[model samples]
Target chain A: MDRKKNISMAVIKRLPKYHRYLMELLKNDVDRISSKELSEKIGFTASQIRQDLNCFGDFGQQGYGYNVKELYNQISAILGLQKDYNYVIIGAGNLGQALANYTRFDKLGFNLKGIFDANPKLVGIRIRDIEIADIDEMENFLKSNPVDIGMLCVPQTSAQKVCDILVNGGVKGIWNFAPIDLTAPEDVIIENVHLSESLLTLVYLLNEGK
Target chain B: MDRKKNISMAVIKRLPKYHRYLMELLKNDVDRISSKELSEKIGFTASQIRQDLNCFGDFGQQGYGYNVKELYNQISAILGLQKDYNYVIIGAGNLGQALANYTRFDKLGFNLKGIFDANPKLVGIRIRDIEIADIDEMENFLKSNPVDIGMLCVPQTSAQKVCDILVNGGVKGIWNFAPIDLTAPEDVIIENVHLSESLLTLVYLLNEGK
Candidate 1:
């Protein structure tokens, strides 16, 4: 497979959606699907699907369409899910605890190695058998454990500080839930799950016609 | 104060971000900001900021820049934060409970009216004085209470079913955390927070150069 260079961010964003739909098809034991059929399920246009798949590699055949299992594996590889990621949650608050308990990430090869919190009451609690450590210990913990991803669930005031610790401690990726956007080096990737922004967007759209 | 006709989705998506930055300026007692200053803070170009704000109304005078409080208030109104939205969470698992306990939404004028879960273990448990009810009772509850938004944190298999019930009961918006893309009527707005896809995006970026 000849790898394509400089895939657009729009195409990168769609890769996960492709991965998701392909996974669903695999679950239902669907052996093959045409771009038109996949488009109907995924809500992207058929041409858009063909174009997106072509960014990573030639996926679908002209007459035979796409082999479901093959497409799924290709997207999975494109999404970098072929390997496991060791991670840590920086805050053990309601959101952090919830994310810690979410088993879906585990299924997708994200392994949670530690959970840290500043709250004394929460610091000793065990979630999924990984005892919550004091936030103060996170720097040393990350030094020894060597995390690939750091999940930021801390409050906004402390988010940057926590993020700095993660970056200095060698974590390359940040899955931020904190409301504030933390600054990071160019090599580090930050993906924000801004819940407030998302809700406000929904509210704005719900009232768009009015 | 004539609003621009047909604001693009790209501009609409950036509104919440502008709202957030403007609110921060207000918090710091900063009364005015140039587009360049805001651009530095927000990571968008000065021209881009001006273009986005222009979608809703004329903001920012040449040289005088923008009045922080006024811009904040206008963006708040534009984002529909002026009115309170009564909402229900349809699954009381980890993510649902995390969102329920997320007090930031409450501060932004989203009121939690009820919480519903199919799990008997979570039923009747009170989160911020609002008790979780039987998931089966949600349809009847919405009939009497009339929520504006439904937060779907349920499993993939049940998300669409739960979404349909909310829509049928007259809910106009959905803040979805489930992994699946849900179907709703044209008028009903759906905003998704796909955590798995987000994590995958980060993983893909982290490994992009490898």
Candidate 2:
């Protein structure tokens, strides 16, 4: 069964954690895992895991555990990481360059296609076998390379403009590092990745004795 | 009344957007706004605004709406952001540098104390008035600076090591950009600012036609 939208947003949020832990099982050559063992590994309750897994339908029988590989594939497919996407970076600044060098993104099926920058001076700069191109070249570049995801590393001042360009260029989605929010067409998705905000929330939590 | 735990998390989540919209209101010089008007401006339902705001107790007068300045102050205080926190960015890499230049953080009462890096070549370098200190000097620097919040922009492999050091030096909260899942003492709060994961989930939503 397809993952249900009716499922709680909290359940959707934890799918990545479940996927990560499942990948560990795959790595260890484990063939199957009981919900109890999985919960122990991930520090989650077993009943929550069974309920979460059941939302997508029965992956295991009553007395048996789930097939590690099969469950991993299902969660991976649900997360859209089963297939690698051509991931390009827009605006080759410190943020973009840092993301380009970030090795973990590649492990989860994000392939660095190229980098684009609005600055003339940065054009043609090479980072990890990816050349930084002029922002104006984004349209033509995507037309040829067919990038599915574009990481917007542009400035807050230029975030909306750059996102518009990417959206018009047919980018399916964006990973925006800009501090500002960009409203896009319903067809195009934008995820605002603000690190400091998350940290501040953690500080708020620590102060609250959480 | 001190904001409760539930109010703290919920308020902190809304603060960034509220702050952004408040700045927009300030720019437009829109003074008085009712719950309905505020909801329309931010695309939140009136009931959601009322519920979210009411969790911290009634801030708006009946029918007369909320005073812009007064509501903003209430939100800031509820977010524990009325008092400025000395914030430091550990790992002066691409993400670190981008965060160093994030003006919004400071506008929301976060002071960028310094950027810490282990690379000898990067040591003593300055990014937007935040000096780059060697990670070796982390304990000494943190003791002297006494920052309440730290934003981690280090590599995933270095996450645990950095957290160990930071916690040892009295850093109580961390905003981790690295992909690694870190285990910290209960006293030390750690929040994973996983950008790509959030983006990939959005891609999953689009592919699923959500």
Interface RMSD of each: 1.4, 2.3
Model 2: what TM-score? 0.90
Question: CA shift at B196, candidate 1, in angstroms?
Answer: 0.4
For residues B1-210, what per-residue lDDT tens digits would candidate 2 score against the true structure? 544654645555776577567667776888878989888778778888888778777788998988888787776665567687887888887778888887767777778877889889889887886678888888888778787777888877788898888888788878888766788888877888776568657666656633
Candidates' lDDT values, in order?
0.90, 0.78
Q: In model 2, state the lDDT of residue B40.
A: 78
Worst 10 residues of 1 chain B by lDDT: B1-10
What's the CA RMSD for each of the models?
A: 1.3, 2.6
- Which residue pairs overlap in candidate 1's backbone? none
Task: Give the per-residue Cα lDDT of candidate 2 at B141.
Answer: 83
Query: What DockQ does candidate 2 have relative to the true complex?
Result: 0.54
